[model samples]
Target: MNILIFFPSIDNGGPTNVVLSLLKGLNKNKNINIHAVYFWGDNDNNLDVINSCCDSIYKLDKVNLKSLYKLLAIIKEIKPDIVHSHCLVPDFFNYILSLCYSYKSVSTLHCNLDEDYINEYGFIKSHSYKFIHKYILMKINNVVSVSKSVLKAIPEVKAKTILNGIEELKTPLYKDNLDVINLLYVGRLIKRKNISFLISCITEINKIRNKKIKLTIVGDGELKSILKIKSGKNISFIDFNDNPFACGVENTFFINPSLSEGMPIAVLEALSLGLPVLLSSIPAHIEINDKMTDGVQLFDFNFESINNAIESMLIDCNNIGYRNKIKSQFQDNFSLNTMSDNYVLEYKLMLEG
Candidate 1:
């Protein structure tokens, strides 16, 4: 089976990680041939790994007629049995392209578009994106959402749920009973992330705890300069990294205090590394919390709750073999192996239909 995956871009983000994991997992299947194509976004960290997984890859200049024409040329050459795409532009083009081609189309809904666009572009454009997205969605053959929370943006569409996954990290590292707890946040710095809320919470947590909390935010964003100004010596920052774990995942409590998410891959990556995570009480994070008995905890945006979560994480992290238990659950459920199996089933459904 030949499968072609298209993305508007492949930057350092959750959706891109999902595509990379999908390619790697599906590549292992002897019956399958993978082709990965992207425009405008590049990842120095994962390009080689992505190259290893795909039968072929195309990194076009930008999302334009020229690129689309080039993509169509590749599709004509491969004659892929199914074409999978991510994000808005690729979703629209894949649907339009499928009209002239015989192959089926699949799109993964990576974010709550209504909430995402409202935060990124404001009221008017958010609705515009929503209307356009729903129209394009109706024309696509299959739609997949990373979490049920994301489906709220388009209740009319019967989108299937496929939990996002990542390949396991090489080593699960933990530094025990340290005087300082390393707190980590990774993702694009954007309005919806509300990262300032997180920095404030971490600042308040340090005021009362002897086991001091230090937040290491690993990503570049519009708010980087503003956030750095508000932060203190305890807070550190790294420019956007395709591999955030390179900063060191050891003895860290990964935290995502985002206002919204669609199965955040950074959270999944943290779990794979055996780092207990404290997440905001968003519907998406709650879904992940509900799946497990330990290692994942939900906290409100307030200082008290986040402080309590850190204390709880310290206790949990110190438990003998707790990291191993966390990594084990991640392997059994959220790993790329499981994600590929579920996606392959969806592909079969599309092909058989």
Candidate 2:
């Protein structure tokens, strides 16, 4: 079967990585012919990885009226059995294209659109975009959400919860050094991610402990410059690493104090690599934390709560046995093969209908 994966752009985040994981997993099927199109310019490194997974790749100079026509032309030429899109813009565009063509289309919700939009833009603009999105989504074939929280948030539009998955390594990476506890945060430095909150907590921890704890942030965004100024010597920033699972092995713990999330791929990748996690008490994080209790800790989106959670992690950072147990639980539940198989089934079902 021919499948066209449409994305707004290739960026350093969970959504892009999730799409890449799907492409890699689906490519294993001999009958599947995968083609991917990006609405905007590509991230060179991510594009190279995507090129290896897809049979063909197409990129529009930018998302505009001309690009829309070009996208439609490519869709007509490809004549794919299914068109799967990620993010709001791409999903809406695919819905528009579906109106003109007779092909099955599916969209994956990467976050709670309502909250995300309001957090980025103000309430009025967010609500306006929400109305537009709801209108377009109502006409889409199928909607898949990465977390139950996202599906619940969009009750107006029907959606299925399909949690993001990562590949399970044959041998999990084990951190050898236990003297200095390394805490890792892997995602964009956006306001909603609460990167500043994380920095403050780390700063507080350093004040309590004499540089025994270190935070390694592994992503960049708009707040990079401001965050660097706020961060001290205990905290260090690194460019986004596509293979976070490999990086997780070098760290003692993973922490995400984001205000909101939709089954964050970084958290999943970290858990799969046997890194204990300290997450905010968001619905998505709670859903995952409920499954296992030993190596994962959840805190509210406050400085006091974050400071307490970090202290707890520092105390238990030497517990290798607990961390391994978390890895075993993650392996049993979230797997790249299982996620791809479910999407393939969804595509078949949509086509049959």
Candidate 3:
């Protein structure tokens, strides 16, 4: 099977990681010939890993009518059996191409942005985004959502809910039971991440414990400077990396205070490493049952609530036994093999149809 994966850029993020994991795992299958096309400008250095894993790669340059002519030419050449696009823009382009010619196309919705993201990103308030997206789903052969939360955003659309999987790595050997508690936040530092609330939670937790809590926030973004200044003693920030699981697993606790999330892989990595998770009371977080994770706790996106949850974890650290059990369950449900196999199955179904 010849497959084409389209994404905006290969920059380090959840979508990129998900696609890379799929490409890497799927490449090992001798039956598949996978290719990746990205829109970002030429970056041979960034494309090295993708080129190594895929059969071919392409880039989009201009946005005018001429670009569409180039796109159609590329499609005519590759004639991909299955075109799997990630995110909104690529889906739109796939929708246009599907109308022009006969091809099996699939889109993976990574964000739960019904209207929130459109507004936040300054996209026109007009329902055009939804209209185009719905039109694509109605016309395209298949669509996949990374999480139930993401699925809910496009209700009634013909789509499958396939959870994103984490690459299985050797679990970290050391579990911190040191004097100072380690709090970790792993994700892009943005308003949606609720970094401010995380900082407030740390301050509140310090007040209750009357002790120093070491914090290591992984992932850089626009709010880096603000976070650094607001960070109390013993807190530090690290830039985002393609592989952040190891960095986050080093800490004792992983805090996800995001206002929204589409199956955060960081939480999964933390749980897999036996690090307790403290997640905000977002719909996405609720979908993942923490009772399965003994030490994982959920709280409203408030400092007091987060502080209480942290205190609960600090008080009963052995609860991590349950968290480890949950992590194992996640591994069974969301391993890279399971996710990639599901896509392969989906592709077969599309072809059969």
Candidate 4:
């Protein structure tokens, strides 16, 4: 079946990794055709995923109004069996196409579009926008979300909450070097992510324990320059990489003290690799902690809580029972194949209805 997948970019963030993995992991039985329309440059890195997996990829200048005409023409030609859009841009276009075409349409609300956040995004802040979201949710054949917290933000629209997936490693790494327990944070250096809070955690933790804690923050964003100037000892930053899982192995803890999130693919990947996670007590993080234990721990978005969690975990980093429990739960349920199969089923349902 032909499936057109729309998202902001395949170049950055958890959604990017989720999209690429899903594009590659879906059914081998079906004649799967993927149409990706993104808002970023079609660089070699981005095309690597598309060329290897998708049937066709288009990176249009999203800000250009004329692109809509071209986009409509392409959709009309593809005549896909189903259309799946991830964010606001695709949401609007898919609605437009649904009006002109006969194919079924589906959308994933990957983030919280609550009044608080919507207010910051211009005209999207209006009551009419909320109406449109509800209208689409009622009209669209199937609606899926990465986090229940995201769905809760828009209570009028009931949605199926499917935790994002990750591919587990066959051989998990165990590096218990006392000199350096590598702490990792994966995501853009944006305000909402609470990047500064991480630094505070590290500093406070060191003050209490005086242990060697090195941090690697993977991903660049709007706040990079100021963040660069502010960063202290043992903290480093890298641009968003498609292969961020490389860092998952041997990392003592995956830390994400974000103000908000959909289900974070990074945390899932880390847990899949048997790395313990320390995340903000956001609903998305709490929901993905399948073990129901503090193995996948949570703390408030503050230095005190983060420092306390780190210090407490340090005392038991080698607790075999805790590690095994986390590893088993992540591998069994959050595997990439499981998520892809669930999505494929959703698509089939849309086609049928």
TM-score-wise, the better of 2 and 4 is: 2
Candidate 2: C-alpha lDDT: 0.82
TM-score of 3: 0.89
Q: How far is candidate 2 from the true structure (C-alpha RMSD, Å)?
A: 2.6
Which numbered prediction scores highest in lDDT against the true structure? Answer: 1
Candidate 2 ranges beyond 4 A from true positions: 169-177, 208-211, 243-251, 311-320
- For model 2, what is the alpha-carbon lDDT of residue 291? 72
Clash pairs (backbone) in predicted model 2: none
- Per residue, candidate 4 scores C-alpha lDDT tens digits across 1-353 of 89988777766566777787688776343668877777775457756866677777777675556777777877888888888887767777777778888888888887777632543354646556666666777677668988778887677776787767866755445565657878888877777788887787787776677868888888887888887787777787777776664654464788888888888887877777667888888888878764446467778866677777876777667676777777778866777888888888887777777
Candidate ranking under TM-score, highest first, comes to 1, 2, 3, 4
| Sequence-dependent TM-score of model 2 | 0.90
lDDT measured at residue 131 in model 2 versus the true structure, 0 to 100: 81
**Tens-digit lDDT string for candidate 3 (45-128):** 457778888888878875556666667787888888988988777887888888887788999988776634664565674366
Give the local distance difference test score of model 4. Answer: 0.75
> Model 1: clashing residue pairs?
none
lDDT of 1 by residue, 149-266 (tens): 9999799888899898888876535455566688888887877888999988777767765547788899988888999899989899998755677776477889999998989898
Which portions of model 3 miss their true places by more than 4 Å? 41-46, 123-128, 171-177, 245-251, 290-295, 319-327
